[model samples]
Target: MSETETIYDQIEIEDFTFDPDTQLFTYPCPCGDRFQISIYDLQDGENIAVCPSCSLMCEIIFDEIDLQEYLDQIS
Candidate 1:
């Protein structure tokens, strides 16, 4: 399937919880787990967040500038 077709949903970056220690952004998944993606992966232009307990993935919506600003604050 195409990338757009495979995404379970599109979630805004602000809705996710960021763990500074692991540098991971996460959101609740329907499968009783969290969908996770690394900040480094996002910086590299990867936006898909996957749940470890199931076959669900979501596309993260974010602006590059906002991401950079967040990183700057955390740094």
Candidate 2:
């Protein structure tokens, strides 16, 4: 199966909490742990956020321009 087929859901970037300290975006996962993706990964054009405690993964939906704007603000 493809990566797209493995995605549990599609979550908006805004729905995640951004931690400037770690530059990680996180969201609550059904498995009781958070799903996480790094800003660097996003910058590298990666959109999948994974739960470290489980097999669940989510596709993050965001615009490149919007991500840049957010990064500028945090920086």
Candidate 3:
């Protein structure tokens, strides 16, 4: 079985880069790679941003309603 990932930080959702085209959210990882999550992942209630280059993750702080509103404004 896969091990559960641990969150390194609880950062505000505003700290991530939200791409309008791909609808993906990304944040800088200390390892120089970016941690990424998708808009659909947010809609599905996923809040963890995982770094592809390392075993690091972060919790994204965002309200469901507020997140939807923000997505609406951007889209």
Candidate 4:
């Protein structure tokens, strides 16, 4: 049987607002619903955006694409 891929493994964002100068990732909004999330400095945990209305979270991996970009591309 094949193993199910995890959310972290499956979801990948493109054209993420990454500042080559600042070396930071930016997510304007990553929620399907009206509730949105904007996360930055994901590795540092200094910036995290969560939507209580839709139970959505911008839990972006530092080296990976921002969740927002993924969501936007799909939707």
lDDT tens string, model 3, 1-75? 146757889988888888877888899999999999988888898888889999999889998875775588566
Q: Give the candidate order by descending TM-score.
A: 2, 1, 3, 4
Q: Is candidate 3 or candidate 4 better by TM-score?
A: 3
Residue-level lDDT tens digits of model 2 in 1-75: 374558889999999998887889999999899999998899899999999999899999998876876687577
Q: How do the candidates rank by lDDT, highest first? A: 2, 1, 3, 4
The lDDT values for all models are: 0.89, 0.89, 0.85, 0.39
Q: Please, what is the TM-score per model? A: 0.87, 0.88, 0.84, 0.28
Clashes of each: 0, 0, 0, 0
Query: Please, what are the lDDT tens digits per residue for candidate 1 over residues 1-75?
Result: 365547789999999999887889999999899999988899999999999999899999998876885686579
What TM-score does structure 1 among the candidates reach? 0.87
Error of 2 at 55 (Å): 0.4
* Collision pairs in model 3: none
On the 0 to 100 scale, the lDDT of residue 67 in model 4 is 43
Model 2 misplacement above 4 A? 1-5
Task: Mark the regions of model 1 whose C-alpha exceeds 4 Å error after superposition.
Answer: 1-5
